[model samples]
Target: MAKFKYIDHGQGGAPACMTLAEREWEQPAGRQVLIQVAYAGINRPDCLQRAGAYPPPPGASPYLGLEVAGRIVAIGPDVRGRKVGDEVCALTPGGGYAEYALADERHCLPVPKGMDLLAAACVPENYFTVWTNVFDRARLAKGEKFLVHGGSSGIGLTAIQLAHAFGAEVWTTVGNEEKAQACRKAGADHVILYKEQDFEDAIKAGTGKQGVDVILDMVGGDYINRNIRSLAVNGRLVQIAFLQGSKAQIDATPIMVKRLNFTGSTLRPRSDEDKGLIAQALAEKVVPLMEQGKCLPVIHKVFPLAEAAQAHALMESSQHIGKIALKVQE
Candidate 1:
């Protein structure tokens, strides 16, 4: 037994699955390494897991958090090169809300120079999702026009900066002036006040009615149909989440006439081999930018690990502009 705590909401109770309890963890297995977590990143999926809406994938740990950064405390026999005490940020198979977590060695990245564990913690989930959707799935190229909805969100901010850094002309929708400035500072060419303007009209006007090349969307609902209208011919709309809602009554005419493609993915359920590919791609394409301070994560706040419930409250409040993190250890 050790001084380890983890979030478990599976047991039936008042908050049921969102409860925090002490637990001892076994050593890493196969290519996995056990990490003494310093900080864990909060995400929408964590909130869903709390409410028992999103369950961990088969064979994954039954904990809430998805990503963490810390020192590697131990390594399994199959792991190579990486040794105990390596400073790393890793995408986990859940269980990041604890003092310790295990991750595949292939999924770990060195913490960039001048970055703390908190910033590193904020990187994995959002960056992995953005890279998988915006670049791999959407295939956004240099000089392409890209639009991101929910521009102030954890994943939205990362998408904005990454698209911009990759030489795309980025456009985004924000709720207020503060969020607008944040996106603008992240190199967005245009910030649509989603509350005050029709985003479809804004996209049309901003692109001279040509529409955008790709759209990275998390806001679903009517925006689904509107997203089709906002894309140019042969455009892609990658839906990563349905924050507003899903199940939209959309017209097929626009999709057919425009030759548009609609795709959606949830990263948690992806295979380890698939995630390892993403990890390698990120190491090559994105890590250098991170080292140079481009596409760095925008952290909104950091809550102590004991206050995991409060962290979820802030995420649901939708008031934060970027990633919310949990300080899990020293």
Candidate 2:
């Protein structure tokens, strides 16, 4: 057996728990492909996993990292549609922090034409997540009003660009003026400085009290009720994370009266078939936009693979305006 270097977060604690370590490499099996990773994306879930909050699903790799962009060096007997030397950015089940990683062929998307591997590495997690939650689940249509919280995040920026590209009125909430500018440049129609104004109130006033048609939210704590209140009569609210906390006490009367739908999902635990469907959708609809430069991943910073701990620390600090990545090879 061969060996490879990876970040190990033994027993899981803080960002400092992650360290460069070695493990024996395993051959790709079934539909998996062995990637000589060039870069791996850093996401909020990665930080949560490192802090012992999120755990990998059954049969998934235990290491941190959920997305990577690299070349297929080997393929399993069952693999199809991908071959050795194909350049792809993949949504990995786990272990993306390694010099080598295994990804299901179905979860891989070609690096968009004219895009670098570093930018491609930032795509899988945020794009797959936004595609599923905002489009597939929330059904955001052209001319509809959409609001996403955490406007400066990779997920937030992805949502802003996609919704705008699809002809929706995009709104977002950010922590400061710089983040507000980033969101605006990403195609946001309105940017609310959460530190200075109330998001629910802003939405109400901005839309003439009609509220938004769809809301993609990650701030769960008290924002749950505010999200509910910010929806139009037949609106949908998609909750993807709980940055503040999950539990909330809210009025249920509005849900009944307004006929609003509240739903959400995490990408990692989804079935492979479901993920494949999303990948197909992205390749068909979103990839063209990438090729046209209409919407693309916004990378904020990159760190060497050994500095994954520093990457996580930067993520948890919430200072970055877009995606962070780790350079795994060269």
Candidate 3:
């Protein structure tokens, strides 16, 4: 049996726990394709998994990493559209940190024209989450006002660009001026310094108490109530993660009075078919924008596969303004 190198976090602790290790290779099965990974994206969920807070779904690989960009080297019997030597980016079911990984053929997407593997590696996790939650679940529409918390994050920047491209007004909350500028450069109409000013107050004052039409938030806890209060009459609030804390004491009055929609989702646990649909949507709608240099991913840093610990440290420090990736092949 062949072996490949991957990041291993024994018993799951801090970023320091991750180390390069070798694992026996497994052949592609079912509709899966084996990818010779060139790059793997570093996401928040990957950190959570390393810390033992988030666990992989049943039947999913227990390793870290949710997305990768590479060339398809082998395909299972049921694979049809993908084949050997095809360059693609994929949303993996886990184990993206390895030199090679397995991905459902339906969840793999062609690398956008003129985009490199590094940028392609950053696309699947952020794009799929933003598309499904902000558009499919929240029903964001053209000309509406939109706001996203953590403006400098990969997800935040993606939402800002996509919403602005689709003709919606974009607002975002950032920790500092640097992130604010980054968000503005990404097409945000309003950038609020969450540290210097109250987001709810800013929203209330900016819109004359009308609030925004939709808000995509990852910081839960107390922000939940403020998110509820900082909405227009028919506004929608989509929660993706709880960086602060999941448990919140929020008033239910606003939920009923405003006719608001409060919803959210996690990408890794979703069915393969659901992720395939999202991939199809991205290929049809967003890939053209990427080809035209619109709504492209912003990469802040890239580390060699062995330095995954340093990458995770940078991510947890919340200092980077865009996506982080690990170079797996070269």
TM-score, candidate number 2:
0.99
Compose the digit string of candidate 2's lDDT tens values, residues 94-188.
Answer: 99999999999999999999999999999999999999999999999999999999989999999999999999999999999999999999999
lDDT by residue for model 3 (137-250), tens: 989999999999998999999999999999999999999998999999999999999889999899999999999999999999999999999999989999999999999978
Give the winner by TM-score: 1 or 2: 2
Error of 3 at 306 (Å): 0.4
lDDT (CA) per prediction: 0.90, 0.95, 0.95
Estimate, for each residue in 72-129, the C-alpha lDDT of model 1 and write its tens digit: 9999999995899899999999899999999999889899888889999999999999
Candidate 3 has which clashing residue pairs, if any? none
Candidate 1: pairs in clash: 9-17, 9-18, 10-17
Model 2: CA > 4 A from native: none
